[model samples]
Target: MTDLALLQALGALCVEAGRAILDVYDAEAIVVRSKDDRSPVTDADERAEEILHAVLAKLFPGVTVIAEEAASRDGAPTEAPETFLLVDPLDGTREFINRNGEFTVNVGLISRRAPVLGCVHAPALGATWIGAAGRGAFKAEAAIRDVPAPAAYRPIAVRQRPAAGLCAVASRSHADAETEAFLEKLGVVERRSAGSSLKFCLVAEAAADVYPRFGPTMEWDTAAGHAVLAAAGGAVTRPDMTPFDYGKAEAGFRNGGFVAWGARD
Candidate 1:
């Protein structure tokens, strides 16, 4: 399949997974559990993951898929292949538990240690963001199980850094002093707190100028949003401004501190 076609497939998959998540989210009771790592999980997470895994296995047979719930249950691989997928079935379980409209379903493709394609779908918000290496980036109002038409998707790009000072988006659940200090150093004139990968989409769509993440994150947590931001003319790098690549099987796919910038000077 072409890159654009692949991107569209991923987006559609996310939307399908998002539908499963919303079904659980709208239930009368949402049962929350804790992973071995102590992070929250719910029925929404598992159901969405099941949908993604089954669809991915059929859609792209033989490609390795490292998903969050499965990795937490079964140990992660010590190394990754040249090409693979990272999935966060239900990002921001806390937001879902809180009945907030900030959770998302994320799927990202990593090739040669770089995020080449991704899709993030926020079912509660009825929005989806997609990006690929050569296809640019776009946002659409995706409904449950119904992928938006090509014309329905609007191309999006990062905005040039504003001279007035940067507008920064930070993690709402995992705030830290390090992130605050970094934003302070950046002279952030405006601040927004968001849950899940939406912070990256904020920068990707020019709603914010940057996102600095000092708290711990996994590859699945950031990869899809990273692809979107990168395709929208942005960058994600270490706090020291080094290159940020994926397939860190040595680190159990855990992410280090990184900053995502829109258009930079």
Candidate 2:
């Protein structure tokens, strides 16, 4: 598919799944379950992932799609081609359960183990961000009833480092001592807390200067936002300062500690 076509489809899929998530979010009671890994899974997660899987199957026939809830049930494929789809229908279940409106639906296309296109939709926030390789990243008002086209989106990019110091973003739920230590080392002027991929989005749009994660994150957790950051002239790299790679079933798709930086440190 052409870049624009793929982005539109991904944006629509993410928006649709976000609507499904909101359906459960607004309900009286939301059922939650624990997978083997003991992570909480809610009705919204499964329902939205199902919506995404179905649409992705139709959009890209025969592509290997790795979705969080589905992989937990059916097992992730040990091997896949260079190109595939990764979906995290509900990226911040904790925030969603807490009714914080910080959760997001993430859909990413990976090529050569790097995210090429991605869409992060925050249903409760009524906003979505999308990024495509060579085309740049954009943000749009996420309409629950319809997916806005790229024409309705605003292009975004990272900013140069501030003269004072770096503004850092960290996980609101998973912040830890190690992460704090890392942030301190960055000469941060101020620290911000956020849930899900919004941390990466903040850096991508230059709202924050850096995001350092010491806690565990799955590929689906970071892929969409990583793509956006990268497209916006930012980077997500390991503590060792190497590029992050995906399709790691050996590690159960879990990601190591990493730092996301805007244009400058």
Each model's backbone clash number? 0, 0
Note the Cα lDDT for every prediction shown: 0.91, 0.88
Pairs that collide, model 1: none
State the number of backbone clashes in model 1: 0
lDDT of 2 at 187: 76
In angstroms, how far off is 250's CA in candidate 2? 2.0
Candidate 2 has its poorest 10 consecutive residues by lDDT at 142-151
Cα lDDT tens digits, model 1, 1-265, are 8877777787888888988898888899999999998989998898899999999987779999999999999988999999999999999989999998899999988999999889999999888999988789999885655777767789999999898999999988988888888888889999999999999999999999999998789999999999999999999999889999999999999999999999987
* Model 2: lDDT of residue 149: 69
lDDT string, candidate 2, 1-265, tens digits: 8786787778888888988999999998878889998999998999899899888898878888899998899888877678988899999999999899999999888899999889999998888888988999988885564688667789899999999988998999997889878877777889889999999999988899899987788899998999999989998889999888888878888899898989954
Residue 167 in model 2: shift from native, Å? 0.5
